[model samples]
Target: MASPDTRTQLLDAAERLFAERGYRGTSVRAITDLAGANLAAVAYHFGSKAELLAAVARRVIEPINAAQCAGLDRLLARTPDPPVAELVAAFVGPMYDEMRAGDEGGARTSRLIVTILSDPAEEVRSWTGPAEDAVRDRYLEAFTRALPDLPPQELWFRIRGILAVTAVDRVEVHNRLAGLPPVAGEAAKQWAITFLAAAMSAPPTGT
Candidate 1:
């Protein structure tokens, strides 16, 4: 049996490499080399590359999702009906912290998730869908409660918008705009939160 420390090392190495090269771009040998483990160790611990990728995702994603849910729960407990902005913050804040904390592994996992989600290939869904759904359902419920009057279709649109912005934000792509000042991390998050809150609250156009 692999020691706990060895398992952790393997996961750490896998997370960093997968983040850097992506799942398809990275290889089991590369991960094992970086981890200082052998091929046997990888098989013994995670079973396969696909499983390793899933493990890497779960290590980071599950915690962030839990934090998001906890934040929502705390807000709901304090007040029966929190404002749209607070709800948005609850959903976005933990993710922002992960992106801003300068954890390379977390950043890589975030990028990996965006890559998988953006891919139209159904196989990618097998790795990412369950983790995404676990947190998504909670936020959907919270948003539903926060904006009960919002039409279901419109609410789904706004929720998807929030997720799209989040994926883009995680990748941290820099697009140069002429004469536009840079927005720092906190500022960027605030902008997204404000935009999402407004989007969630906006009345249906056809109504």
Candidate 2:
């Protein structure tokens, strides 16, 4: 049996390399080499490379999802209906906190998450779908309550936009925006929350 420390080492190495090279681009040999473990270690701990990728994604995503859900729970307890801005913050804040912590593994994991979410590949989706879908459904319920007047199609569109913004913020792309002043750290998060809140609350245009 792999020790807990050995398992962590493998996961950390896999996350970093997967972030840098992508799931298809990375191989078991490289992951074990970086992890300083033998070839058997990956199979011993995670069963396969695909499993390792899922584990790495879960390591980061589960915690963030938990935090977001907890925040939402608290807000809902205090008031059954919270403002859209507060709802947006409850969803986006935990992720921004992780990015701001300057944890190298976290940043890499966030990048990997973006890649996995964007990829059209079925294998990756199968691994990530359950956890991602649960988190998404929870937030969708809250947003639906907050914007009861929004047409279902429009609400889904806004939700997708908010998710896209969250993913972009996680990758820290605000710095790369040409002709726009660089915004980093908390400023970027604040901007995203405010922008998304407005988008969510916008009066529906009949089209």
Candidate 3:
């Protein structure tokens, strides 16, 4: 039986390791050792290394998802229909805020997201570690609403672009973009919102 604190400690270590080495690169012993915990703690808290990796990924992704969902709820509560811009912004704002706040190694998470976007594993790509299929479905409904006139494929493209822009990798890129200064996560979030707003608003070509 692991102590409650041991669980947190193990997760903290696992998050760092997973972010640093990726899923295959990190080892259970490494995580346990880093946490100053025993192997039993790892198994007790999370059944297997795969699960632990997923758990680590969840630690980073879950909060962002919650924030996004909450933001969406707020918009929906105010109006069943918001302007496309606010809808896009709401979809992305919590992420920006999280990155800006820079806790939970968000900068790293941002970079990780870039990797995921370009080439995600079977698991990570399955929408934030497999808990809420409905969330993505819900977001898609919001997206479809925002771009009512666009074809489904076009809307999906725009959504992909928005996801790409908001990716943690972009945050890293944002570091190098001149005139942007070395801002953090929130800046990335805001820029993504602005860019997405434009993309969402752009007139659809005859398609």
Please name the candidate that would achieve the greatest TM-score relative to the true structure.
2
How many backbone clashes are present in model 2?
0
C-alpha local distance difference test of each model: 0.74, 0.78, 0.71
Global Cα RMSD, each model: 3.2, 2.8, 3.2
The digit string of per-residue lDDT tens for model 2 on 11-41 reads 8888788777778888999999998899998
**lDDT for position 174 in model 3:** 57
Model 2's C-alpha root-mean-square deviation from the true structure amounts to 2.8
Which one is best on lDDT?
Answer: 2
Kindly indicate the candidate among 2 and 3 with the higher TM-score: 2
Report the lDDT tens digits of candidate 1 across residue range 106-126: 455567667666656555446
Superposition error at 196 for model 2 (Å):
1.3
Compared with the true structure, the alpha-carbon lDDT of candidate 2 equals 0.78
| lDDT at position 128, candidate 3 | 57
lDDT per residue, candidate 3, 118-137, as tens digits?
54467545545444556667
**What is the lDDT ranking, best to worst?**
2, 1, 3
| Segments of candidate 3 deviating more than 4 angstroms | 1-4, 99-105, 114-131, 170-182
